[model samples]
Target: MGVTLLTGASTGIGRSLARRLAARGEAMALVARRGELLDSLVIEIEQAGGQALALPCDVTDRDALARALASAEAELGPVTRLVANAGGGEPTFVDGFDSAAFEAVIQLNLIGVANSVAAVLPGMLARGDGHLVATGSLAGRRGLPSAAAYSAAKGGLANLMDSLRIDLRGRGVAVTLLMPGFVRKHEPKPGRGKTGRRRSKPFRVDLEYATARMEKAILARRRQLVFPLSLAVAIGLTRLLPFGLDARLLAGRGRRRPAAAQPPRTRL
Candidate 1:
């Protein structure tokens, strides 16, 4: 819709991004499983003098995503930007994982992103101007003991976008992979966050900080943006570690120590 299309707008970072973009007066199309939530966001955006269309659709549905884009075009204008953010935090365990949740994560986090990209690319290519962004996580660069599926999906998305970036580089389309380090949400208590020395055992990130990061990347049209340098470096190192040591570290196996008692905040 003129500038942006957002998926996974029901809550968390997606919702925050939507609000921020609206405040900046960008036209948008919001998608999520909950039409009710999109409705509420649409009301807020419109009242703030921004144009938006709420196209409730599951990001995993290839055809549905394409149809929603058409609707967004008809209602607003050309789609100039897209946030492929529909995702799931799944398989939240080691051996105790749920097969269904694991599968669903791949479908939503990986294939869903693919669907969103496919839906918008044709028009963007024709116009020769557009930006495609996908919300990835630091976890994408490493496998956490419990978040196997999530890590896999996000990692897959990063790889997928890498190739897409190459294919579209000279086509006048831009691709950005935003890797955030656990941005906390107002709700979702597990991520609300605390402060100081204990340093919020949970995944700690402030909304403003994340929004600023996204704003810069979106404006500059950068590629493969990672955040919180410390976490970024850690994940990068994980790839170079010997498999045994890496496995032990990630699984929380015997390693001397309290330093990691709180564990790394690698959650989605």
Candidate 2:
């Protein structure tokens, strides 16, 4: 296996996936904005007899991202697989529409992937072998209550990956899009949402569960993968409903405004 380069490797899903890939003896280049965290992770992997190079990067910056990719190739090896897993979004509400905030989300979730693809695809095309993996979300399937910005960003990413998958077919570069739902830091607990009502995450899974399935799909080069099955099925059913009805059904769900800013983590 050639070097696998992953962004957002400091925490959450990216960190989990990095650990799993390392355990499987894959030499990797870990990228994240937090250099200290990346260094610590590198040390841990090295102690475990796994090879890893920590390359601090912010995926939103195209030039910086390109430099990081080049460093990965120089230090680890040619990156045969690129996981564009760096993204985060804040809730966007109709009552308080912030274009700057919305653009930030789009930049991270959509343009960030584009930057990563631009940086890596040329080499993959030249070599005729590479895998491009992106972490999307079930929220991308449709517009959510207060996640207008996030939903739009993820939706755009889904289409971008789909288009790339179609265009790159038979070209030796594989594109895999992973759509996961409700990956929480811990077990679900009942809590009051923005509407001041108790809410629960349906069919939520932990980081470990999400990482295992994602790793399998990435390794197998699956075209598109959605999990967990229960949530995917439920979201699939929602797609068939009339837009008006679907909107009504989910209006009360996910209406809570997140903190002022959220760090790059798994899509919620």
Candidate 3:
């Protein structure tokens, strides 16, 4: 198998996908901001007889990401597959409207993907064979009340991937978009508080299952993949409802109080 470069490989869905690819004996370069986590994951993969390189860099920094990609190519051979998956989002508060925070989210979630693509596209185009995959979200399908920034970022990402798919067609580079909903990192422990309970997200799927489905899509070169059929159906149904009624329904659903502002965790 050709070497695959995966961003956000330190945690959550990125980690899961790396593990799955490693198990299949695909050589990989794991990229993330957390050097320690990348090192640990590299160790685990190597111990299991997989070839992997730990590349610690922020995807938001184009120069740093480009350097990391060069290092991976030197060690593992040219990266024939690129997973542009590093992203996170803070809730956008209409009351406060922090433009800085909104801009940061867009930079990380959308521009970060663009950076990853820039790092690999030249090499892929030269070779005339490669795959580019990105993680989008079902939330991108429509705007959510409290998650305006996040929804916008994801929606923009989905469109970006779609445009790439069209442009790259017949160019020997395939683009795939993974649209997942509510992937739970871990199950919440019992007996926290109402606040903790409210923090818990719904329609969650375990990492293993999500990874498996993602792998299948990547291997099949699917143009778009949306998981957890139930959530997809629900989101689809909402589109058919009357605009006023749908708006009211969304309004009736309570939103969690905004937490203190902080950078979103660098994970998908």
Q: Estimate each model's TM-score.
A: 0.86, 0.91, 0.93
lDDT of 3 by residue, 1-268 (tens): 8899999999998998998888988898999999999999999999999999999999999999999999999998999999988887777667778899889989988999999999999999999999999999988888766777778999999999999999998999999999998786776666532356554454678878888899999888899999788888887777789857767777634355446545333222
Which candidate do you rate higher for lDDT, 1 or 3?
Answer: 3
lDDT values for all models: 0.80, 0.86, 0.86
Ranking by TM-score: 3, 2, 1
Off by over 4 Å in 3: 192-196, 252-255, 259-268
Top candidate (TM-score):
3
Residues 147-243, candidate 1: write the lDDT tens digits. Answer: 7788899989999989999999789998999998767665445533353332342345677788778877876888877887777887678778885
User: Model 1, poorest ten-residue lDDT window?
Assistant: 253-262
lDDT of 2 by residue, 165-195 (tens): 8999999999999999988766544554223
Q: Please give the TM-score that candidate 1 achieves against the real structure.
A: 0.86
Candidate 2's C-alpha lDDT? Answer: 0.86
